[model samples]
Target: MTVETIGWNTAQRRGFGELIARSWSDAGLRLRYEREPAEVLAEYDIHLAAGTTAPALPPSPGELVVETFNAAEAVPPPPCMLSICFCLQPDVKR
Candidate 1:
């Protein structure tokens, strides 16, 4: 199984979330928060039985990556019904 992760800057979080929530649905993805880059790790239903997989943790130094254990496969999370994430920021109200 393979998972997807997305990292957004602190200032870009609201804008990005709003845009996604506005167009995305309830995806089965999980959000793993990390400091510094402020990242969100999204796992997919995809798997890698015979091939090599990537890791999705601690990420990497200078750069981030998908941490995959030997038996750990990534699965795509449920897709959101909405086109984006409803950002409830004080400055961003629909």
Candidate 2:
């Protein structure tokens, strides 16, 4: 599969980290993200390309990583999928 990760600048990454923390504590924000992930991301000035599907958040907060997979061009892999993993944690012991 062809995997592409969005190039996030330092500022964008920082914003995303903050967004993650907020969403973890706010139920409403999490609900909005589930329904309209793109809209929620836009608030942080993170926009996906046209025709790109916004990924859903993990069951629980941990880290923030977004990866897109294109299966049309690549062989194998039944269905294409977007992966959003990891969470922004502040010095929590593993």
Candidate 3:
């Protein structure tokens, strides 16, 4: 099994959600997001922090899980994390 993770800071979750909501109905935007996520995210005013990089979306959809952390107190919690796990077939040698 191969696992991939995408991380979004606390501040960017809302904008990222907006992008995802829009992409649900906009095919072009969806394709564009897949190809150029940073550019698309900029449209939502979601910019990555210095030295941070956004991971490319999975080649094809498989098992995906979105997790958000929330503390009991009013203090902010950790960033939003998305995990994707997929099984890859082993290479066969002839």
Please estimate how well model 1 matches the true structure, expressed as its whole-model Cα lDDT: 0.32
Pick the winner on TM-score between candidates 2 and 3.
Answer: 2
Candidate 3, lDDT over the whole model: 0.53
Q: Highest lDDT: which candidate?
A: 2
lDDT of 1 by residue, 13-50 (tens): 44444433422332322232222112232211222333
TM-score of each: 0.21, 0.52, 0.45
lDDT of 2: 0.61
Per-model C-alpha lDDT, please?
Answer: 0.32, 0.61, 0.53
- lDDT, residue 50, candidate 1: 38
Where does model 3 exceed 4 Å of error? 1-10, 55-94
Tell me, by TM-score, which candidate is best. 2
The digit string of per-residue lDDT tens for model 3 on 14-77 reads 5565455445445787899878777887876776656667644334334344333234652675
Model with the higher TM-score, candidate 1 or 2: 2
Ranking by lDDT: 2, 3, 1
Instruction: Pick out the ten consecutive residues of candidate 1 with the lowest summed lDDT.
Output: 36-45
